[model samples]
Target: MKLIIAVVQDRDSNRLSQALVWEHIPVTKLASTGGFLRAGNTTFLIGVDDDRVEKVLEIIRKNSQVRKGWMTPHMGGGNEGDGSYPVEVQVGGATVFVLSVERFEHF
Candidate 1:
């Protein structure tokens, strides 16, 4: 068996859940906090047979996305990357993990 761990943005948690359910994939969801950005996140725990690993990975890949931070020119024709140092807020993305499950049990 394999344990699939998907960490996704809180904004798209509901959508991801619905899609997984549509594929008949069972998941255990947990609300979590992002480490770098301190934003909310959703963690998904899914246990499936070994053969289904690829399918589960595909689902996560389709949903969890990497976002880019756009920088622009500031006053005095200085680029954002210039050492002028403008204070702006930005959030980091999500992470995912998968591991082999030796055993899983339920009451």
Candidate 2:
């Protein structure tokens, strides 16, 4: 068995989840936050047979999109009137990890 952990941006979460459901793939969704951007994210826990891992990954790739966004970074050790500028950064992509599961049981 394989465990697929997909951390996707909130903007793409709903669409991705729906697509997975449409494909008859069972997924557990969790609300999460990103450390760097402090933005909202959704984590998907998908357990599937080893043979189906590639299909699951393909679904994730098709659903999750990469986009650009602006972020204002905080300046450290600055004066009272220090100003922060918005920087363009790439976002809206899934970080996925596939792990081998020793055992899986459902009640």
Every candidate's CA RMSD: 6.2, 5.4
TM-score for candidate 2, residues paired by index: 0.76
Off by over 4 Å in 2: 68-89
Error of 1 at 26 (Å): 0.5
Q: Total backbone clashes of model 2?
A: 0
- RMSD from true fold, candidate 1: 6.2
Clashing pairs in 2: none
lDDT of 2 by residue, 1-107 (tens): 99999999898899999999998999999999999884899999999999999999999998886777788776454564667777898767889999999999999
Listed in order, each prediction's TM-score against the native is 0.71, 0.76
lDDT of 1 by residue, 1-107 (tens): 99888888887688778888999999999999877664789999988889988987777777656555445336468555576644453433457777989988877
Measured by lDDT, the strongest candidate is 2
